[model samples]
Every structure is written in C-alpha cells, then in structure tokens.
Target: MVGRAEFVSRFGGVFEHSPFIAERAFDAGDVREPMTAGTVHAALTKHFRAASQDERLGVLRAHPDLAGKLAIAGGLTEDSRKEQAGAGLDRLSPNEHARFTELNAAYVEKNGFPFIIAVKGLTKDDILRSFETRINHNVQDEFATATEQVEKIALLRLTAILPES
Candidate 1:
C-alpha cells in the first residue's frame, strides 16, 4: 500500500483542488491495498461526501467554468485541459464560445457554482445542450447534480491514472 504522502501526491487533486478529501480518507484508514480506480474512488468519495457543505461547495467553486475565461487564458489544470480539449472545447467557434460564456455566467449566477459535467465522450454541442437544460433546474437540485458530476469527473480522472477494479 502507498503511504499517505505518496497517496496524497498522486490523488490530491482528484476532487479538484481538495486534497483534504484524500488526506481525510487516508487519515481515516479508508484506503487499502489493491487501489484500483473503483476502490480509491470509493475512499475519496466517502470523505468528499462527509465534508461540510462549505467545503463541498468550495470544491465545486474550485472547478473552472466551462469554456470560460480561465480556459481561454490556459489556466486549467492538466486533467481539465485534456478533458476540455477532448470535448473540442479548445476549438470552439466564436459564437459557440460566446454561448458557452453566456450560459456559464447564467449557470453560476443561478446555482452559485459552475456547470459541472463529466465531458469525457461529449461533444461541444452536447455540452451546450446540457448546459442550457441544466440551467433551468432549481439551485438545490442543481447543487446535487453538480456534486454528482464532480464525483463522476473524479472517477474518470482516477480511471485514467489507476487500474479499474
């Protein structure tokens, strides 16, 4: 089994900027050997779910807005950059970019957090459609949806870095 330092170093950003989830999981002795993506994701999700609402919201807030200024400025994390580029977000036309920007603003304004999607196999249009649909959800429902999306993103990231169970 990996020690806490190595474990945290490897998986700290699984929950976006929240290394505390990994630290809390390791400190709780939740992580075990045979750390496949499924096992590690379970451990991390446990701690993430256990975190206070503010902490969870912080995790959500830590995520970069889709096709927003940070992405345009090239300020996303490596995983995020690759994921967005894979979705063709990096190559959006100006009109598509504007739509994304407008939708991102409205989503954040209503939900108090950015739209969160797994975006692994999704196209730009797929994302835009999702954004438009999800924006109409009430804040409470949207928060739950965003939280679930964050977990999905974390799992996808883990799958790339670790073996599946």
Candidate 2:
C-alpha cells in the first residue's frame, strides 16, 4: 500500500485549492498517521470559524464545474466519471438526453458554475433529481449546500486515503 506521505502528496492538491478543505486534510497528518474523521471534522470546523457570509459563499464559487470538460478531467476522480458516464447520456432516450443537456446549460447559467454533488453512491437518476432540486435554490442556499457537499467529498477522500481499520 502507498504510505500516508505519498498518498497525501499525490492527492493533497485536490484539497489545497480550498482553504477549508486543505487545512482539514493536512491536519489529518502525514503518511505515517492516516486521516481520521475527527481530524477532518476539526479542520472543517476551523475553516468555518468566523467566516463572513461572502467568504462562505466563496467556497461554493471555488468548486469546479461538474460537467465542464476541464472539471471532468481535473476535478473528478476516475471512479466518479465512470459512474456518471455509465448512467450514460448516450443511453438516455433522445428526449431525456436533450432535457439533460438543457438542464445542464440552464443550471450552469443560473449558478454561474457547474452543478456539484457527491455522486459516490447516487445513481444517474438520483443525480438528475438532485440537480433539479438544487438548481432551484437561491444563491445563498446553494452556497450552504455546496459547502456541505464539499464536506461529503472530503470525507470520501479521507476514507480513500486512510487505511482500512
């Protein structure tokens, strides 16, 4: 197995761009000491400290677009992509695909960013449903939601990096 240091070194960049996430991930420790849920939670709590409303909103802005080409390539993990594609836009009935495309475009336009949700366990239909629901949120509500989603993503990453106990 890869040591903790190498694991952190390799994937730390994933969190570093976001101060809240980076600090949380870093606090989990080096290669020798694997991340724990406590560490992740502590980091998140610290980052959230005294954050202004706008600063909190900025966290949402920091997320990479979900369907944007660069986001697909840089932000998403290989497994996530496979899961998303397996749901297969291509397999969607022509009308469904067209609706998805339209929804995606409108969502991006409204949010000024790509729709993001932790898709680890969710099916394509679930994701589409989440998109529809979240797309209706006002900027402030969505900002809060995005941060919560980021926390979920961080937790997922933490599990991936830590050794199985």
Candidate 3:
C-alpha cells in the first residue's frame, strides 16, 4: 500500500482544491496495491459523496467560474486551464466571453455555487448550452447536478494520472 502522504500528494487536487477528500479516502483504507484510475476515482468519490451538503457545496464553490475572470487572469489550476483550453474556452470571441460572463453570474446568483462541468470532450458551444439550460433548474437540482459534475471532473483527473484497469 502507498503511504498516506504520497497518496494524498498525488491525488489531493482530484477534487479541485479539496484535499480532504483524498485524506479521507486514504483513511478509509480502500486503497490497495496496483491502484488504477477507476479504483482511485471510486474511493475519492465515495468520500466526496458521503461528505455533508455544506462540505460538498464548498467543493463546488472551489471551482472557478467557467471562462470567467480567473481564466482571464490565468489563475486557474493546471487541470482546469487545460480542460478549458481543450473546450476552446481560452479562445472565446469578445461576445462569447460576454455571454459566458453573463451566464456565469446568473447561474451563481441563482445557485449558491458556480456551474461545474467535466469540460473534457465538450465544445464551448456545448458548454454554453448546458449552462443556459442547467441555470433554469431549481436550486436543489442544480446543487445535485454540480455535485455530480465535480465527481466527473475528479474521475477525469484521476484517469489522466493513473492506469484505467
């Protein structure tokens, strides 16, 4: 078994600034030899899902607004930067940026947290459409949706760093 420190160091940011999830997973003792992306993702997400609503909301809120000021300022995490760039979020036209800004504000105002999506393999247009549609969901539903997206993002991050198994 990997030591707790090394496991946490490798997987700490899988949940977007939520290192406690990794710590909790390690403490849960589910990590075994020959760890794979799938197994790591499952263990991390198990603790994430089991966290309190407030804790989960913190995870959601830790995510930067899609294509917002952070992206403009190059303040996003490396994983987020690459994922957004992959979706063409880094090359937004002025109008597209404006629309994204508006949508981001509206979504955050309606829901307590910023909109979170996996972003991998999705186009900017696809992301915008999802943002527009999902913004209309009730707060409870939106919260649940954001939670799921966080899990998806974590899984993708894990897969990038570990074998699939």
Give the TM-score of each candidate: 0.99, 0.64, 0.98
Better of 1 and 3 by lDDT: 1
Deviating ranges (above 4 Å) for candidate 3: none
Q: What is the C-alpha lDDT of each candidate?
A: 0.95, 0.57, 0.93
Error of 2 at 132 (Å): 1.3
Ranked by TM-score, top first: 1, 3, 2
Scored against the true structure, residue 101 in model 3 reaches a CA lDDT of 96
Write out the backbone clash pairs for model 2: 4-31, 5-31
Clashing pairs in 3: none
Residue 77 CA error for candidate 2 (Å)? 4.8
lDDT at position 121, candidate 3: 95
After aligning candidate 2 to the native by TM-score, how far in Å is the CA of 123 from where it should be? 0.9
What is the TM-score of candidate 2? 0.64
Best by lDDT: 1
lDDT of 1 by residue, 15-117 (tens): 9989999999999999999899999999999999999999999999999999889998999999999999999999999999999999999899888899999
